[model samples]
Target: MKNVIEDVTCAGCCCVCDHIQVTTDGQQIIDVQTTCPQGQAWFAQSRQTEKQQPLIKGIDASREAAIARAAGLIQEAQSPLLCGMGQSAVDAQRAAISLADLTGATIDSGASAATRALQQVGEANCTLGEVRSRADLIIYWNAENLRFNAHHQQSLVPPGEPVPRKIVTVGSELPGDSRGVDLSLTVSVEDEFEILWRLRALLKGVALEGTTAGELASLAALMQQSSYIVIFFGPASPDERLFHRKLEALSLLAREIQAERRCHTINVPAAGATKGAEPVLAWQTGYAAAVNFAAGYPRFSPCEYSTVKMLEQGEADLCLLIGEDPLTGLSDQAIQRLQQIPLIHVGPVPLVDLQPEVYIPTGISGIHAAGSLYRFDGTPLPLRALISTQQASEAEILNQIETLLKPVMHIC
Candidate 1:
C-alpha cells in the first residue's frame, strides 16, 4: 500500500502561508512544514482522538442532548448573535448565513470596522502589484511593526532592481524584520499628527509650527523628491478618532501631491489585501448590515451593532462563537461576558473553563478543509484538505442544527 501524506494550508492565521506540507502515516498527520507556531499547534490539536463530552451550562451531556439544548436556546432567545467566521469553510459560512436568515439572528465577523475604514479609501489606494510595479516612496504611518500572524511572509515583498523602494516609517518603532525598506523615519505616536501637519505645511511651502524633529525634515525632503508613493496604515487603536485624523491628513497630502506635482499617492492597510478587494469588497456592500441584523432586515452601525460592545454591555444572552477566539485580544469585561453567556462553541479550540451548550471539534481551516481564501494582494488561492478528523465536520454540524431547526421554524 502506498503511504499517502496529507498536505494542508492555513488561512486562519494572517501570514496566509499556503505551502504547508504534511506527512501522514494513515489518517494522522505525522509531520508538518512551512507553517508557523500557531499553524503547527492548530494541526497538532486535530490529531487527538478523545471523544469530546458535549456540555450545557457546565454539565456534561451526550452530543444529541447538547445539540437539542443549543437549538432550544436559539428558539427561546429574542435575539441571537453569531460571531466569528474567518476560519470557517465557505460552505459553513454560507450555512451560518442561512441559519441567521432562518432565525432572526445577528452574524458578524472579526476586523469588520478596519475593513470598512479601508473601503472608504477605495480608488484612493494601491494594490500590491501597483506598489511593486511603480511606487518609489513608501510611507508606513503607524505600520512599522509587520508581525506575520502565520509564518515568514518576508519573501512576498522582494527588493526592487537598481535600488529597493524607499521606506518612510512614521511610528514608535521601526521593524527590523522587513528586509527591503530603504529609509525609516521613526516618530512618537503622540506627535504623529503634528508631524503630518508639518508635512502639509512643507508641501505647500508655508512653514510655521517652529520647525519639526530633524528626522521629520529628512522625511519631508524624501516625500518632495519621490515620483510615486504608497502610505500603509495600521488599524486605529482605542483613541480611534485621533488616529483617523492623522490618516485624513495623509489622504489630503496625497491629493495635494497628485494635483500639484502630478505625483501618485495611495493608502493601504497593514495586513492582507489593499482596499475595495475581496473580503473588504464584501464588507463595503450590504454584507455587514445584512449580517448584523437579528430582525431579518439589514442594519448598519459599528457603534450600535458591534458584537464586542454588545457583549460588554451584557446584551446578548446566547452567543454562537465561530471562527476566532475572543479571549485573545478582547477586553477583560468582554471576555467575562463570553464566560457568562450560554456559548455554543463550534471550532477547533475546546473550551476548558466555560462548558459550551454545544461543543464541536472541527478541522483546521485551509489545512484540513479545502476552500478559497484571499491573499494580501486580492489573489484567490485554492486550498486542499490535508487530513480529516473523526469529530463532525463543520458542514455536518451545521446541517444537523438546520435539521433540528425545521420543527421550530415557525416559533419565532
Candidate 2:
C-alpha cells in the first residue's frame, strides 16, 4: 500500500523547509513536493542510493566488531579530536558532545566562525515569520548567502507585503535576482567593514573621518525611517577571509540601531546539516564549538581548539568524524591533516578521497530515521522517517559508540 505523509520536513539545507509533502510505498520514497531542488535531492537520493557497510581499515566488518576496534583506538590515543555534526540529528549532536566529554577529546564543527563572533557580542536575532510579516526594511548583507536557501527570497521577501518592503543590497556581489532593490551599495570587501562602522557612528551621532559612501548615509536614513529592519547576512566571500571581524562589526551596528527602533540581524545559513549546532553545543558545553574537554571541563577557545587549528598542527592522534554536509565545516588544510590521523567515521554521507580506520554508514534523520532538526531561524522542526532501511540511525550509532567507550573511560 502507498503511504502519503503531509508536512514532512526537508533536511537539505539549514532553511529546514517543513512544508514538504512526501509519497512513499512503505519501503522507498516515490515523490516529494513543495520543496526546492536541494530538498528534492535530499529526500529522493537518500532512499534511491545503495547501502554502505561498516569497515575496519578497508576491510568490511560487523558494527559490533568495529566498535571494539574503535574503542581500542580511543583508549590508546593520547590526544583525540571529535569533529563533524553537520548531518547528524540534535540527539546525535548531544551524544557526540557526551562522547567528547567522556573521552576528553577536542570537539569542533568546521563552521564555528559565526558562532565565535556571536559569542563575543551576542546576536540580535528573531524568527523568519517576524521578518516576513513585519520588516519594512530588509537588507541582504552579502547576498551570496541567499544561494543556500531557495525559498528565502519568496518566503521572507514575497510580493504584496502589506506595506511595500524597501530592499537593500550591500557588498558588490549580489544574488541572481536584483530587480526590486531600492538601493544597491556596491562596495569592495575591504571597504565593507568600514561601511558598517560608519553606520554605527551615524546611529550614535558620532562622526568618523575619511568618509567613503554617500550611499552609507542614505542607508542609515532608511534604517531610521523604517518601522522595523532586518539584515540578512552570510559569508563575506568565497574564502570568508575576514568573516569574523565583519560579523562583529555588523552585530555592534545592529545593537546600536536596535536601541531606538526595532532591528534584527539574521544569519543566512551555509549549505550544511549544521542547523541548531551552535544551540545544542552551547546547551551542553557552554560554548558552541572549538571546545576542548581534555581538562574534564569544557574550555572555549576559538583559536586554540578549532578543528582547523588542531588538524593543521597534527595534534590529534585519533579523530572521530561524525556525519557530513554538502559544504562548509572542514577546509582543505583541515582535511589534509585529518587524513594523517586515524579516523572513525559514522554517518550517512561518504567522504571523498579519504578512507577511515572505521566507517559505519548510518541513516539520514529525515530520510530513513526519525529525529529533530532546526531551521536557520533557531526554530525547532521534526524530521519524519519516510522509508524503511537496514542501517541504524545516526543517534543510535553514536550512542552505541559512546556505550563502548564509557566502561573503559570509567565515568560515573
Candidate 3:
C-alpha cells in the first residue's frame, strides 16, 4: 500500500478539471480517484502491454531507431509540414516553430485555418471575460450538450440572488438540468434553416414564410426579452462555413436588437484554445498564408492552403504532428495520406489507430508539463507542473530534435 495519496489536476481535455486524485506504489501508479472515464483512460495504461509500444512502418522499433529515422526524414524532405501544436508543451510548440523556421516548413496548430477566421472576427468583438461577466442572454446553437467538453459551463451562471438572465438553447432540446437558469427555450434542429430565416425576417422587418406561427411567436418573445446576448455554436460537423454564415445572420439580428436594447454576440467553436490564441498570433505575425508561404513574398487566401486540402491532394511528404489526435478527429482521406507520409508525432498518444512511423510521446501540456495555455477568454494561463516523473519532458526532446536537425538543414 502506498503511503501518499495525492489529488492531481487533469488537463487532458478543455475542461481542465483540477480535482483528480491518485495513489502510487513506489514508481508504479496503483489507483486514481475523482476522475471521469476519459481522465482515467488518459492517465492509466489499460492494455496488457508490459513495455512501451513503439512502431515504425507498421513494425516495432527501439526508441533510438525511431528518433533517428524521424530526424532523417525531416532532413531529406523539402516541404515538411509541422502541424498540430495544441496538445504538446509550450516548449515543444516553440521547438516546432524553430523546426519550421530551420526547415522553411509550415508550422501550424489544429484549426489553424478556422483560428485565422476567428481572429478576424475577434478583432471587432469583446473578450470572453467581458461577455461572461456582462452578457445576460446565453444562447447555444447546434450545441447538443456542454456537460462533456466544458462541464464547468453551468457554473458560469451567477448564483445566489436572482440576476435577470435568460438562457435560451436554439437547438433540438433544452438541457435536462436547469438549476440556475431563468429561461430554457428549445428550437428544432431539423428546421434550423427556418429558425434562422424567422430570426432574420424579424430583424429585417421582412415577411415570414412559415406555418409554425406559435413557435415563431415564442422565439420572438425571447428575442424581445433579451437585453445582452451571447451565442455559442458547436463545430461538431464539417459545415463550419455554413455555421459561420448563420452566425453572421445571428449577429445581424443582434445588431437590430441592439438598436432598441443593449446586446452582444459570438460563437465558441470546438477548438476553444486556438480561437483565443490565433487572432493575437495572426495580428502579431500575419495570416497563415503569410506564415506558411514558401515563395519570396507573403501571400494571403482563405481557400488556398488548408491542411485538409494539402493532405488530400497527396501534396504532403513529411508530417510533424504536434498536438492533435489525427487518428480520430481528422477525415479518413486525410488520415490515409498521413499514414503514407513520414509522420513524427509529439505529445500524448491519442486514443486512435495511429500506427505512426515515429511516435515520441511527450509530457501532457498544462499538467505534467509547464507552459502557457490560452483560456477561452483570450487570457493566457501559465500552467506549472504539480509533480515530477520519469518520462523525458517534451521540451527536452524538442530541443534535441532541433539540435539534430540544425546541421542537416545547414541552419545553425
Best by lDDT: 2
lDDT per residue for candidate 2 within 295-380, as digits (tens), equals 98999887878777787778888888888642255568877877788988887876667888988888888888888987777888
Where does candidate 2 stray beyond 4 Å? 48-50, 145-150, 157-161, 206-212, 236-241, 272-276
lDDT (Cα, tens digit) per residue for candidate 3, span 1-412: 4734444555455544445666665445567674366667655642222234445665776656766777888888877776665445445655665666666666544454444544344322455555556667766665544423444464364455445666666556665766655544465544665576687676555656556655666666776777766666655354333444454545556666777766665445454333322433354346532145455333344344445656777766888776546433356787788878778876556326666677765555544557765544444556655334444556676677777887767752
How far off is model 3, as Cα RMSD? Answer: 4.4
**Model 2 TM-score, 2 decimals:** 0.93
- Candidate 3's error at 160, in angstroms? 5.4
Worst 10 residues of 1 by lDDT: 272-281
C-alpha TM-scores of all predictions: 0.79, 0.93, 0.78
Which of the predicted structures, 1 or 3, would earn the higher lDDT when compared with the native? 1
Q: Give the top-scoring candidate (TM-score).
A: 2
**TM-score ranking, high to low:** 2, 1, 3
- Mark the regions of model 1 whose C-alpha exceeds 4 Å error after superposition: 1-8, 35-39, 48-53, 58-62, 115-123, 126-130, 144-153, 157-163, 175-181, 193-201, 208-213, 238-291
* Candidate 2 vs 3: which has more TM-score: 2
